[model samples]
Target: MSKYTSFPEPGDDHNPFQDPAVTQHSSNTEYATLDLYNPFDNKNGPPPPAYAATAPSAPQPVVPATTPPSRTTPTEPRNYGTSFTPQTAVNATTAELLRKQEELEKKARELERRERELDSHALGPGATRQNNWPPLPTFCPVGPCFYQDINMEISQSFQHTVSIMYYYWMFTACTLAFNLISCLSLFCVEPSGGVGLGLAILWVLLFTPCSFVCWYRPVYKAFRSDSSFNFFAFFFIFFVQVIFYVIMTIGIPGWGFSGWIVSLAALKTSVPVGVIMMLNAILFTAQAAMGVVLLKRVHSLYRQTGASFVKAQAEFATGVMSNQAVRQAAANATASAAQGAFTGAAR
Candidate 1:
């Protein structure tokens, strides 16, 4: 008491330096306290406490456990936007592939059906569906006709000849029909109706079949076959028919009923008959022209075959020399001539 004054300081009651427990408590308080304003930190509030900074963060704001939308939903509308994800793209690609596969299957089935139909309808090898009636002739005449095996390789000139020949045949057939009708009309007007009718009937019965067999058929065969023999036979027969046509056109008065007879009957009886006859005359004239043209075409065909009078004579000689029947006939004729010559001398 003599050495030091007994005076109490302002913080003597809580002397933190003198008491360990006080010091420890003060440290704990300091650590727990937050600095609302700190010069060291640029943040709006004070920095985190040292312990909090050192410790692991309270498990980061637990992210919501979410599942992505399914792309495979059939009811979902297609998203055409550029924002589509990879999963959606994969689904769209798979769907498109399936659709295309279905389309391909349908097309394959259709093609298979068509192939079966074609196979069923197929007639024969090298034959088509168009091989029907009415004989659709090809534009190129030098080819196959109605018959499969029968084909002709003719020149353009020869084709023109064939066409003209067909026209001639048609004209001739028409002329024959016209002639028959005219004869019938003339017979109706004639005084001897029965006789005229009989003649007309006879002419129709005889000439119709005869002309077809002798002339038209031969010509048709010639064109179809391109046979030299058929051509020659047609020319000979047709030449005779043409002569008959001319004779019929002349009309022998009472015996034969013809276009000319009809015209004569028309002058004597009916104007209608005359008109019909005149029309017949026109047709006959046209037919004659056609015949002439056909004859020229026939001659052209003949020349193409290297036929001539000399060739004809050579053929005749060859045939006679080669044929036994012809040779026997010729020998008989020669013997008869000699016998007659000898008999005449003796008499």
Candidate 2:
């Protein structure tokens, strides 16, 4: 008589499928991962034939949730709500994927329920159901294994985009306020006072719009696309401006145009320069911190798309990925398939 027992005897680590009795047990698993792993194994036995139960020879039909009355589905708009598809692994389009995921989740839940029913009917919850599970060798990540998936890589990019939005908002506020106030001052002040009134007018009317279009737009696009080049360009322009402003603050009397009223006689030394110098120091520190943050973000994005920056110290990554990964050949292909979804490429 066949040893109906499915489990390997104790002290066996590698002989799960040796007993054919439990080999086919995972046929009912949600994603059909029964073949992936089997735990109960014994090396010393004749491989058992799978003990798959055969219904008394009748085939089962897959019944739709709601069968159509007669052949009227075509005429009456066969509204079975949403059509479901099995969630086998593959990259399907959005509509197909939503349907697929729903089916997989449904299957998983149903399998769990059936296991519960069998357990309750047979041994009950407190009683072990080790006999019920298929022989699995690997750790099974069944429920919510979605989080453990590499798919979360896409999810993380979304999170990064949110953070970039915050930065964009901050910069937007600074730019808008500075331009509005500075431009207004230019208009109100006399032409003879400070820099040329023509320059101020041009700065207000021209530079504000131009900066917004050229700099801010690209930065925003970089944030959305998670691209490396956009980030590098943004920082390069931003820090250049920061350095210029710092120089102007130190070189000019009041750290701003027309703010210095001190006479050369009163200011013999760079002693009055202390506060401005300190403020410049603080600005530099802030810029450095900002640069570090952008550096980290750009590094992460470059990992997504092969780009490099000075701060990205992962020599293995920046140096190698762009070269051996068939970088140029893959880029156009990836970019095209991704649609215009990627707003910009950075440095």
Candidate 3:
């Protein structure tokens, strides 16, 4: 047996360490020869060499300590590079949604508050829990002239006093139109008919605009603004309007050519003219009635506002005393009266 041989040949069954090739390979690779009795034991391996030659070592990379990335569920998309995680993004989105919802709720409450305030303002101080106006007449006998309908619309569109004033004004206008038509019809049938027609047309054109500017508009403004000055102005102008209407009804001929008397004079020759005159009389009567009604209504409203005769007198005094023209006129009148008295004494 050679000195390097650590085991017997493979065919030698009596010896348990038998494979020569395995023994030789093990010896070349620096492993211990297998002991057959303790082949599976860790203690059977050869001991390490006592003296190992140290070699110049290569520099090792300084690697940071890192934990392995946790496994994510297959359904979740992996985020790269960005610091925002899926849970953090979800949390931020939920917060933003909640903030927007809160803003919307706040706006809704504010809008509701504003709407309530507007409704209260529109209702006015005198508004009761129930509506003030009478309900629509269920059985309209006149077959729907739309009077009730128009009244309802006006009530909805305007304040209570304004609605009443508007109705009064509307009736006044109707009566005025009837009177005008009657005047025109009489003039058409009269002698010197062309001149009469021209005068009637001119009267209509001038008076219609004048009436609106002087009376209707003032009344409308008075009711709408509830201005005391405007109300007084309306009362004076409407009084003048009523006086003019009375004059026209008397038929002075040249003034307005509107009198029922002139129309009655034409009646002997023309029956239609007499009928028109009668109709004009009726319209004028209606206009007068409406004027009285409106006056009463205005007075009632004025009283409701707590104004008295004393207040009216004060207003009148202020208006008169404060006017430069009035002061000048008074001064002139006083000087004239003094001069006249001095002259009379001299005589």
lDDT against the true structure, each candidate: 0.63, 0.46, 0.63
Error of 1 at 208 (Å): 3.5
Over 312-338, each residue of candidate 1 has an lDDT whose tens digit, in order, gives 456557756899998899899999999
- Tell me, by TM-score, which candidate is best: 1
Task: Give per-residue lDDT, candidate 1, residue 233.
Answer: 69
C-alpha lDDT of residue 314 in model 1:
60
Candidate 3 regions exceeding 4 Å error are: 1-161, 193-195, 308-347
| Tens digits of per-residue lDDT for model 2, 103-136 | 9997886666566556556775477433322233
Model 3 has an lDDT value of 0.63
For all candidates, the clash counts are 0, 17, 1
Worst 10 residues of 2 by lDDT: 144-153
Task: Give the CA lDDT, 0 to 100, for residue 153 in model 2.
Answer: 21
Which candidate model has the greater lDDT, 1 or 2? 1
